[model samples]
Target: IDAMLEGFEVSKENFSTNFNGELLIITITLLSFLGLYYSAEKLTSRTSLTVSSKPLAIGLMIAIGIGLHNLGEGLAIGAAIGLGQVALSTFLIVGFALHNTTEGIAIASPLAKTKSPISKIIILGLIAGSPAIFGTWIGGFFYSPYTAIVFLSIGAGAIFQVALIILKWLYQSEQKLVQASIVSGVGVGMLIMYLTSILV
Candidate 1:
């Protein structure tokens, strides 16, 4: 009977460890996607600088939506780290840093064609890109699954919202292909992260 009891206790400990590990992994994985979500926010705003009155309204809407989405990402990051998945969380940080660089360039490309002021471009870029830093710190500290999912859904929704803005901007224009390309570029960021997870 004592031996059986000892085995039961061992099983319980193992179960706890497995549960913790799974939680950590999911939290970190979710945080990785969260970082890209905010990075998209930063990148999308750069495309708004040359818009006319109507497009500017759309731009502002996109920016506001993306900002809220980014806040959600910050929460996910915090929740993930809080759960103790530091390594996976770090991987998210590194991947997002790399991904955001490309995103910055992609977002700025269309604006570059319009001869906008460098200051305006830089300001928009910084506005969009800086949230990654905040999100990273949050993911490194807070680690929670419920928080992560909440942010994930918000971020996903914001991206879809911005995609609509792109569609509107491209409608009935010679630049439709360019607009489509930009939308696809954003998806590329998502795809890259997904592929990286496979490597892990």
Candidate 2:
């Protein structure tokens, strides 16, 4: 959600001169996200794995979503550095590092009951974290606001899809629409994020 908002804000600031181009970019991004989600769903259904497929798929998707978000973060870091804002870059690096720690829990939660291997977990971590390197390089060298908008939009869409999946899973598991634990957990999570955002 934040990523999407940021993307739009950037577009408004940088791409206002090219409204048609901006609209096209947003349309393509949204369609791509829908395609990706459906493709993932199909792949998970067809693939055979030693562990349960759904949980592993959820974890993988979450990793991918977080990776996309982190990519944007990396872009910001590299952009700050590229522009010679050393202090801002350093602060972003530290803040993003701290912020990303919680993402590990998001990736791990679904797989908690599975007998997934450590090697697989490591791969997922790499999937989630490696994009930041590429993002940094791109931001440092190219540093296009247009590119940032696309990446942020895709990240936001991926996260939104993951949230839907998790909610569906929860509903199916409990056979109910809402639960007290879910509400409390969501509230606490939001509160924690808000506090962390202040620090960031």
Name the best candidate (by TM-score).
Answer: 2
Estimate the TM-score for candidate 1.
0.54
Q: Write the per-residue lDDT of candidate 1 for residues 45-145, one digit (tens) a residue.
A: 66446454333334344554445455554554454566777786666556555645654554454454455566766665665566655665665665344
Looking at model 1, report the run of 10 residues with the lowest lDDT sum. 1-10
Write down the TM-score of every candidate.
Answer: 0.54, 0.84
Candidate 1 stretches with Cα past 4 Å from truth are: 1-66, 137-146, 176-193, 197-200
* Candidate 2 structure quality by residue, lDDT tens digits, 31-137: 75796679667766765453477777777877887787788878877888889989888777777777767677778877888888989889999988898888888
lDDT of 1 at 20: 53
Name the top lDDT candidate. 2
Give the Å error, residue 174, model 2.
Answer: 3.5
What lDDT score is found at residue 170 in candidate 2?
62
